[model samples]
Target: MEGVAAHQKRKVMVVADPTRESAAALEYALSHAILETDTIILLHVENPNAWKNPIGSLFKWPSLPSSSKVASSPSSEGLGNGAASLGYAGGGGGGEMEFLEALKRACEIAQPKSSVQTERVAIMDGKDKAPIILSHCATLGIDLLIVGQKRTLSNAILGHKRSGSLRGLDTAEYLIENSKCTCVGVQRKGQNAGYILNTKTQKNFWLLA
Candidate 1:
């Protein structure tokens, strides 16, 4: 089986969305991955409606501010240890900025110690996302699939009060059931902790700071 296969370099795919849950998942994957050389792929599925806007105004990359603006702005040195630096122009439309910013945050979290090669892919939503993710896993020989579990209205109504494990999102569940590689669902645990849920067994493990 693909999950049991031993490979020199492991490729991990993170299904990234513009949500705090997704950021938590990426942070968990980057921080806790066993291997330092793992290749992390950030995948974002774009909505078709995002392309309806005018290309010049909506899709154009914002120009960098002048040196005067930089000098006048407050220093970000005290923001944190590895605060995200946003200077480059990202591709795609307005929604693409969110994905790029998320990716940048993930990169900042994995800095200094981690030598993992990271890449990002923005897929145009011409078809279903589950199939695309599965195909990408097969083509790239992904060793593990990581995704965030966002709470829905149903989850909020019926709460995860039982305490065994919370159900994952549709995309995470689909990939967990059908993907060729191992799948992990990450959920945010309050402000400082992260809960890593195993997809197959539905077991919950806490990663506390």
Candidate 2:
């Protein structure tokens, strides 16, 4: 059994966005699911449309190399500070930078308490995020997939109109239906209950509450 476990190193992928829900998922994994030998990947999918829209300044396609190290400068701007420490590729818009910072911060907060290998990745493509996430799981041989669920005001209103049965968000729903590996969806517990890591100050701040 030890040999089998050694051969089957658990690979976990946490699909995160710039939301507290994503942080909650990572926090849960770090606290309970991850092992010392487990490998964790925090993945963010940049919307392809952002590149095409003239006004959309979120991210650009092929902006940086496939896997380039983030720059290390205090005022380098964007996610350079946190992402560089975590070895994330650079050359994205403010939104992308924010996403990277959030991912890096989550791992940082979790890293000190756990002995696990973690990395962050940004996918810039025109395809739907669900397919991209599913493809990564298949290609990377991920053993577990974790995602976060935070209901927006729109979602809440829609649910109220729909008799309290809310539809799953696109990414979570797709993974639940199609992923070959086990999937866990974490729901945020309270208002402003999540933590956000600031790339510039290298500090963490609690959200909402």
- lDDT against the true structure, per candidate, is 0.55, 0.52
Candidate 2 residue 170 Cα shift, in angstroms, is 2.1
Worst 10 residues of 1 by lDDT: 62-71
User: What tens digits encode model 1's per-residue C-alpha lDDT throughout 1-209?
Assistant: 23533445677888765455676676666556534456667777666566543332322221111221222345433323221233222334444334456364435444323334444555565666777788888987888999887655533353333322223446665666677788887776775544556465554556663
lDDT of 2 by residue, 65-162 (tens): 11122233333335433333333334444444444564555354444333344444455654567778888889888988888655555333432122
Residue 130 displacement (Å), model 2? 0.6
Which candidate has the highest TM-score of all?
A: 1
- TM-score of each prediction: 0.61, 0.53
Q: Scored by Cα lDDT, where does model 1 land?
A: 0.55
Q: What is the lDDT of candidate 2?
A: 0.52
lDDT of 2 at 10: 79
